[model samples]
Each structure stands twice: as structure tokens, then as C-alpha cells.
Target: MELFGQSGNFVLINIVSGNIDFDLRDDNPAPCENIWVGNSSTAPTDGECI
Candidate 1:
């Protein structure tokens, strides 16, 4: 899909089954700081910030 922000910051997470399409605008020129992709029902326990 698409996401927009005033601070030009964003994050994306894919849990199960799907595809992510990111469209960044030149006006913001910002990139996603963190991204998580997995297929686990439990949370991450490796000291991650999940």
C-alpha cells in the first residue's frame, strides 16, 4: 500500500503472507528506520524492540 507522514518517518512490518510496496516521495526523502518480516506467532525474544 502507501504511507505518508508529516515527520517523514515510517516503519513497515510483514507478519504473515503478503507483499509490501513502498513509495517514497521526493518531498520527504525519508526512509523507513526499521522493518520486520516473519511468520511466527510468538514475539521476538532476542532483545529486539518488537
Candidate 2:
């Protein structure tokens, strides 16, 4: 686990919502989602995003 990093793509579990989250898309950096929903592959971040 890395979170909200400047590079790399990976998924981590969000225990609060019981979903997986990612901070990279298409190999680019993205806002790390601490809370998410939906499938792990396409998990979507919801309220209180960071």
C-alpha cells in the first residue's frame, strides 16, 4: 500500500464501504479515494473523497 502517490497504479480496500479503490488511471496519477463503491476493478469513490 501506497496511497495518493505521484505514480503507479494499484487498488486497495476501503473498509468503511467495503470496496476497492485506486489512485491511478491509465498510468496517470489521480486523487486517491479513501472510500469507494461498486466492483473492485471499477470502484467509484463517493462522498468525503480525497
What TM-score, computed on C-alpha atoms, does each candidate reach?
0.16, 0.17
Best by lDDT: 2
CA error at residue 27 for candidate 1, angstroms: 18
Model 2 lDDT on a 0 to 1 scale: 0.36
Please identify model 2 stretches exceeding 4 Å from their true place.
1-5, 17-50
For model 2, give the 10-residue run with minimal summed lDDT. 24-33
| lDDT digits (tens) for residues 1-50 of candidate 1 | 12344343333443432224322222332353334344242332221322
For model 1, the stretches where C-alpha displacement exceeds 4 angstroms are 1-30, 39-50
Report, for every candidate in turn, its global Cα lDDT versus the true structure. Answer: 0.32, 0.36
